[model samples]
Target: MCSSVNAELLVDKQTFTSQNFKTFNGNNIKEVNVGWESYGNLNPQKDNVILITHYFTGNSHAAGKYDVADASLGYWDAIIGPGKAIDTNRFFVISVDSLANLGVGDPHVITTGPASINPDTQKPYGLDFPVVTIRDFVNVQKLVLESLGIQKLYAVVGPSMGSMQAIDWAAAYPSKVERMMSVIGAGQSDPWTTALLEHWATPIKLDRNWNDGDYYAGSAPIDGLTASLMLITQNALSADFFNQLGKQTVPFQALESEPLHDIRKSHSIVNWLRSRAQARATTMDANHLLYLVRACQLFITGHQHDFSKAIASITAKTLFLPATQDQLLMPYHAKQTHQALIDSGKKSQIKMLEGPLGHLEGVTGISQHTDAIRAFLKQ
Candidate 1:
């Protein structure tokens, strides 16, 4: 289990604003804001900066302790500290919250999602918010880097959706990125992955309260959102890992009362999973999740149909880490990306992370590959 730390570290949230930012769909917003956090100090040359993109439902709080008595540190706290994998002692790590991110009421995250109020009508954008792509996310980060006077980045690293952004960074701005570390991510969204994303969104859209993404003032679609999270959580872990979780004992009895009959549920596993899913739904907004799902569905490097041609433009030295047991984002996808990059005459390598945590190995099982990652970054 991950434990809380009482370390005194400053995690500052900063915002960057751009005027009339145009998205991939040719729609323009008057102003766009990106929330970000920085750890460690930048050297005089500013060349030691490393950008860490976040996964789905994650924000800019990538590492360090938010409060002295917080339950747990940042998501990547295990590998990003004074002497950890990325080593804040020698490198300055920066993380940015993507547009339409799952804010979960975090005041520091200033994302424009379905729940955000539209400046034009003073009402929530909901479905009115223009669709965004991975390339758009990379472009916003580029603006942030330039605003900070950072001409070049030592490395661009991320896991899952974050890895997609990292790949986009290398392809979109090859000159600015020196290296890239993509974990449990692909160069493009394949048909299988796209189909999976569709299933995740089906439940949300089917909810009566969804109201075509305009369920802001009314009660959010907690039931549909919880079902979606449950599906994702099951795919995110290996069958064995999920089985272990299922076997754990629950404190509450599983029962349901109906008008005609009382249903007695004895399966502890189903009860546990539902409870966990409900807990996450309480904090997340359904419309924000739908927006992110659409973004992931549309993610493709270089916006090209040809995968090889898409990665041919990437000039950064790249490292691909694919979890061995990931049922959600299969390992073959990462292998295909590595092969495409290699065939394109770009420098790239692949390392399979052997673990039972499935897609979550990219985060929970990260410690197993820290040595290899540390060596790769040093190289």
Candidate 2:
């Protein structure tokens, strides 16, 4: 495991909401704070820039960190080194933390979710952070990049939720990006992913200890949150991988197998679950999760929500890579998006990653596609 890295404070910038646009749910507009990070040095031209968007649980620490077990190379360190796929020797890499990334112990991390202080009440926002969408995420990223004097990217690369942002960058700001890569992600969050996420959120909400999202003053819904996390990890693994382990069948040799009823007896399971969940939970407002989820549910391309128009808006060279064993996002999602890109008269390609790590293949052990990724960026 990478050692925990110390938090490095980035920018703490504010943004206003779109005056002409209302949320899909027709909620009042609101501004937000965006926190982010950068790597390498921008050349005199500022054209050799690469943008990396993170997954749902990822933060601005793309490389390693100080106090936290942040890897020096970062989450995709394997592919972003001096001579690696991103080739830092040639390009300046920039990665920004999303509006609600659940980063911990990182002072430079900024979010509009639960941990943020409510401007009005002067207290933590908790569940009060307004809902945000992929557009919102992309808009904030634009702000971060522009602040750095970067006007265009040689490429924008990311996986899963980050991929959504990458695709959105191409769609919402076509001329700003020369290329895009979306790995283990889709143009829209499918029902399957959303349905399962609901299960994960339930435990956080049902924890009687959860005082309607006001658990900060005292104990949070640690127990319920852990339970939900356990479910998510188990489900995130693909059936093909689980079948090899035969998770359904207990091992014939068992040192200890007892029926324990109390939550304390099951504390080990909860602990393991919480450990994973907490890594991804960050300080997000539970309400922010709802709003983000709702925003995903409202995803539709074009003004009519027709994906044809959405896919057509891509003006950059695009690559969509999905893991074959990803039971969560599934390869079909990338294929659908790829096909839409073709239908929209866009230059795009889909390459399926072959691996057993499941959805995580996009993160862990993904160097197998590093050469291909490098080639795409070279163009």
Query: Once model 1 is optimally superposed onto the true structure by TM-score, how far is the C-alpha of residue 372 displaced, in angstroms?
Result: 1.1
State the number of backbone clashes in model 1: 0
Q: What value does the lDDT take at residue 302 in candidate 2? A: 31
Per-residue lDDT tens digits for candidate 1, residues 1-379, read 0122444355767878988889888889777888888888889999999999999878878887655666766888878877788888888888888988876467657776677778998998888888888878888888888888898999999999999999988887888899999999988888999999888888988999888887888978888998899888888889878666655654333342331253454355666777888887776888888888888999898776766676888899999999999998899889989998998898888999987899999987787888988998898
The segments of candidate 2 whose C-alpha lies over 4 angstroms from its true place after superposition are: 1-32, 65-73, 104-108, 240-256, 260-295, 300-304
Clashes of each: 0, 19
**Residue-by-residue lDDT tens digits, candidate 2, 1-379:** 1222233212222232323234434543354565565555689999998889888666655654433333344678778656678776688887777766655335656666665666678887776656667776777778777777889989998888788888888877788989999999888866776786677678767889778878777876766655665665766676676555544443322222331444344333334445767765554344445445555555543324666777777899989889988877888889988888888788888887887878988988678888789889877
Q: In candidate 2, residue 357 scores what lDDT?
A: 77
lDDT of each: 0.83, 0.69
